[model samples]
Target: MRGHLPNAARIIDGFHVVKHANEAVDKASKAEAGENPPLKRTKYLWPGNESNLTDPRPEVRRDPAKRRSKTARACGMRERLQDIHADSANRTEAEAGSKALRSWMMHSRPEPMKALAGQFRRHRQDILAYFDRPYTNAILEGLNSIIQHAKTRSRGFRNMDHSGTMIYLTCGELGLNTVTA
Candidate 1:
């Protein structure tokens, strides 16, 4: 989305959100010349919601326009990346806004699914950012892929919250929110 919908105010990727965080972390491994830290290691690397997350992901989390080492000029679509930063450098405030979302969920008094909740918050921007932009795309087709995949890979919902979270998170990824995803 950072590439395809850079100008778009709100580009909701209900399906891509989940993969991006993990991808960020994965991408960080190859970025050695940048200031942004790589994907977070360990589940609880970030402290409770206070402010100023020391987690390495923050630097990796900043907007591309903010990247100090960005050397990409007004180039055409990039198919492959040279460094881990290629993701962050091309990212938007919406995609970068996951820091706040993750913070909110991590500190939830009753901590829903700290892990998955963090995942949702981490990608909140990419999911909700669609509303900010003029163009709104459909992601339900992709979300269906997740639902079908989940059902085949795992058993039925263990609990309603987990089930709801899975559905909501998937909706956010697929850009489908029947009930305010």
Candidate 2:
């Protein structure tokens, strides 16, 4: 498709990009948790919003005396990545944000985070496309979820025709009220 549509803008979904960073944090947290009994039940710490840390669920909240660990540092990095998206106003800003994030992740100790950074570096152009036009696949993904649910409820369709019709009925904004009964 890229070959045929050479002029088309390539946009990567922001959600998927953030998901990768979150996964890296999760991996680090899991590894740290294995050796540290205190972190055993702290899996929720990395995935939750930074604001949650101040008023977190009883299980995940950090004690005042306990110093922040490498997992916490990884979580902080994830927050920084999210902030880059939220704060950037244009492509130039996004480029700077991406550079900062890449540099930080490159030096990060977590292997997963370093791998994610490498991915960002390789796909830098697609990732930066978000700033050029703030578009996401969220709507399509939502509609897909609805279609999948309908398919599951019906125990799967026997043919693509049935599936396609179901998708259109559920997702297509057809003005049925204007049609005659």
Candidate 3:
């Protein structure tokens, strides 16, 4: 990107980074579940913000800090990274947070998280660039999701023209003045 678009701010979306971190945590949980009984059926509890955790059991919610499994540790680390992203208002703060997270993950026990640490090292600049230019492809992703839903609802449109029209109709916000002026 730097070769062609010299002036472009190459940013790595924080959302994607956190997503991969959650995936890594999930992978860690799966691997650890074999040796650890507590983690056996808790696969669904690993992914998502630490605050909005989805586990229905009240005991599970209160006892996370007591659990010392790799999965729990990985979840904590992922949450820390998410918090860093949320709190960082400038590149300096983000870089500092990234450095701390990278070091912690690099030394952490989970293999998947260690791999994620390597990723952070390689894409440090791109990740920090997000703080420099806070922009995300969320709108595009949402539009694409809407279009996909529209396509699914249509269940294979008759032709390309119809597909295109369906996508536009699903995604576009058209103003219809029904009342006569």
Candidate 4:
């Protein structure tokens, strides 16, 4: 289903992918925080006590420190996952996801996904046209990652310009050679 281009791709897959990522993130978050609905580590379920996290996998216990509230953490994770999706990003994620969107664009040109080919046959030209593009949106994603990391380390920006300047400069440093407004 994901082996097609922008046109043939179904919108549902995007939601599914993001939803799975969120589940993973949420499960890990709760497991760490010891919050509502205690989560068991499947192969190694941890008891409420520290001594319970015993097993071959090296006693792993995550402490969800007060960096943010549980709800805040969940929201942030969801946002990040959503950011990887284009339809939700206004082509923002397309910069990275659209370009580096695997599973769909990976396969082959000829005998492409039959279902997808049939669906976007009319739009094939535009879909295949992606090759002509000089760069992929992956770069934007890289820039976003840098920005996220910077914010994490610096502990949020003072304001919009402050954050924007930092992100812009970071993009430049990372070789976003051509800056578009």
Rate residue 45 of model 4 by lDDT: 30
Q: In candidate 2, what are the lDDT values of residues 3-48, reduced to their tens digit?
A: 9988888798578889988999899888888776767777876687
The lDDT leader among the candidates is 3
The regions of model 2 sitting more than 4 angstroms off are 2-4, 53-67, 155-164, 173-181
Of 3 and 4, the candidate ranking higher by lDDT: 3
Better of 3 and 4 by TM-score: 3
Q: What is the TM-score of each candidate against the true structure?
A: 0.22, 0.81, 0.81, 0.26
What's model 4's lDDT at 11?
A: 26
Indicate the TM-score of model 2. 0.81
Model 1 regions more than 4 Å off: 1-10, 13-104, 108-112, 134-136, 139-181
Tens-digit lDDT string for candidate 3 (26-50): 8998899888876767787677655
What local lDDT does model 3 show for residue 42? Answer: 76
Candidate 4: tens digits of C-alpha lDDT, residues 1-181? 5555644422234434444444544544454445533333322332122333455422233434332334234334344435554344344434454344333323422122222324334443343344333234555567778988766665565787766666666656745455556
Better of 1 and 3 by lDDT: 3
Q: Candidate 2 — what's its lDDT?
A: 0.79
Look at candidate 2 and tell me the lDDT of residue 180.
54
Cα RMSD (Å) per model?
Answer: 17.4, 3.3, 3.8, 16.5
User: Where does the lowest 10-residue lDDT sum fall in candidate 4?
Assistant: 108-117
State residue 101's C-alpha deviation in candidate 1, in Å. 7.5
Candidate 3 deviant stretches above 4 angstroms: 1-6, 54-66, 152-159, 174-181
